[model samples]
Target: MKVENLYSKSEENPMKALVFDKSGIENLKLKEIENPTLGPHDVLIRVEKSGVNPIDYFVVNYIPVKPMPHIPGAEIAGTVEKVGDHVKGINKGDKVIVYNRIFDGSCDLCLSGREMLCRNGGIMSVITNGGWSEYFAIPDKNVFKIPENMDWDLAASLPVAALTSYHAIKELEVSPNDIVVIFGASGNTGMFAVQLAKKFGAIVIAVSKKNWLKEFGADYVVGYNEVVEKVKEITEGKMANVVINSLGSSVWDKSLEVLGYNGKLALFGTLTGADVKINLSSIYSKHAKIIGTTGGSRRDLIELINLCRDCRVKVWKTYKLEEGAEALRQIMSENRDGRVMLQL
Candidate 1:
């Protein structure tokens, strides 16, 4: 593929990016800045779409970001604009998705294929600049070529939302005999968990207000108030064998209430709230296991891309790069339906 030198050696070029100077939505601005400088092991990408997640909202509104003026976006999808000499197997103009986890290859965690837990590394947007810009550079190993037919929005949602769900579901080891109940079924990660559990042959009970969840492979869709009763009726009082709760404290107790004996619960987010109380007797007596997971591995990402050829995230809305502030605000809106994204 033909490559374009966006950053010239003789003259520098600037690109537009959504950047925040401080921890507030009012501080976000779209300004022209010098293109990200590339290292020998890095590849420059012309971002096409960046997923707007709740974490992005928290980062801009509360979490401290590195280097004062920071770009905040973890899920990224774009075309390769330039590849450094040391970067192999990836060429310019290739469609790709960012891995979103920054890991040092030499770490013991990385060697064990658990890069998300690298002792010396953290998440992409938190430790360094992320993909809210028109042009950004990342290590060649941090990107994977997406299929030519994949939509930009779906590709962008994979790194965080989809990967987190995939990892959590994998940890639970859902099976055909298992009755899986997914809380926050309309949220980004919950939606993927519902589909994945069903894909694994489990009977999926999605807890959400949205009835359309059935279109995404949910065997039963019920409101938050109905989850426990619905699961009981469907399982003939056995309750759920696996309960995936990404809503945090708001549904923590209910999640446990619906679990059957030897049940496993997968946790990956704290959207409503984090602090919660647990009952020791309930856990020990029921033999319940609570598994907390985050991002998936590179191997898991590859598997996800293959398994999701026919699956897609329902995009709620799209905003321009300059409208990123509004996009972040929308992510936290109570009426929001699906994933929000910035389409560049």
Candidate 2:
């Protein structure tokens, strides 16, 4: 889809919104804020649900581009309150999910179906006030209609975790019969990675507590301490075909250790740390390749909804929008397994 234009008009009425007028988590405030008016090419959504993420915490303290009194929420699902005059396919009162990554479709990367790599793209709720409010406006193209019967909170969680995992796994092109080892396989993205890899017909070995990830699609689960040794045993010395490392430097060396010849290592996050010392000799010796990934395209979001509808995506628990901060904390907690959601 193409993003033709994006411009918001100021509305006369104010709506409830969470604002951070200053830096710090304690500075987050919920109050009445001006509602964004609908642009001809935009769709105004009345926020129904949103999910929290660690990046939301980082963006609140960092990302200087967002002005004060900014709203922070990357995973948003809502109803179309109003459709811009020029908007199509979308209508008022439709249940929809927001494609949070805003990109200029005319850019080379965007036109090539690599919108995630588009230099002009800006993450919603970071570059501007987002779904923490009862009302928000975005380009018509950014709005996707979810099945009417779908749970808003579940759809809300899909935009970020589901999209990111889908992108990373697809980037590595995990194939059937491939020996796939996924690190951090219990976190939001990790769990999705486990399921998606299995869906692609790979034999998935998850790196997490054995009991925590057993309910999902993981063929086997092992604690990080024994991750490498266990993979070797499972593969009978062949090692893994692809290693997905979302935890970053913490497991970089180990991830490289379990890779078989021509193995692919997909790096998607820097949760533990960013910097890592590379072993050229190791990579060259194994003929391994490294691929970096991030957010997925809007098309992936659409596909994710279908997957969720088909029960391919799992929903573990949900919290109200009033408990959003706690929901963010839940994702970081050791006890929080699978996807955590927020109902508005």
Tens digits of per-residue lDDT for model 2, 1-344 = 23222223455676777777877767766677666766678888888877677777777666663656677888888998888789989998999989888788899988888777778777777766567777778888788998998876567767887788888877888889999999988776887788888888999999987465666788899888998889989999999999999888999999999999999999889878999999799999999999998888977877877876743445567776556666666666767656676666
State the lDDT of candidate 1 residue by residue for 9-116, as single tens digits: 433567888888888999999988777667788888999999898878988998886756888888999999998889989999899999988888789999999999
Instruction: At residue 218, give the lDDT of candidate 2.
Output: 86
Off by over 4 Å in 2: 1-13, 210-212, 312-317
Q: C-alpha displacement of 178 in model 2, angstroms? A: 1.0
User: Candidate 2: what lDDT?
Assistant: 0.79
Clashes of each: 0, 0
User: Candidates' TM-scores?
Assistant: 0.96, 0.92
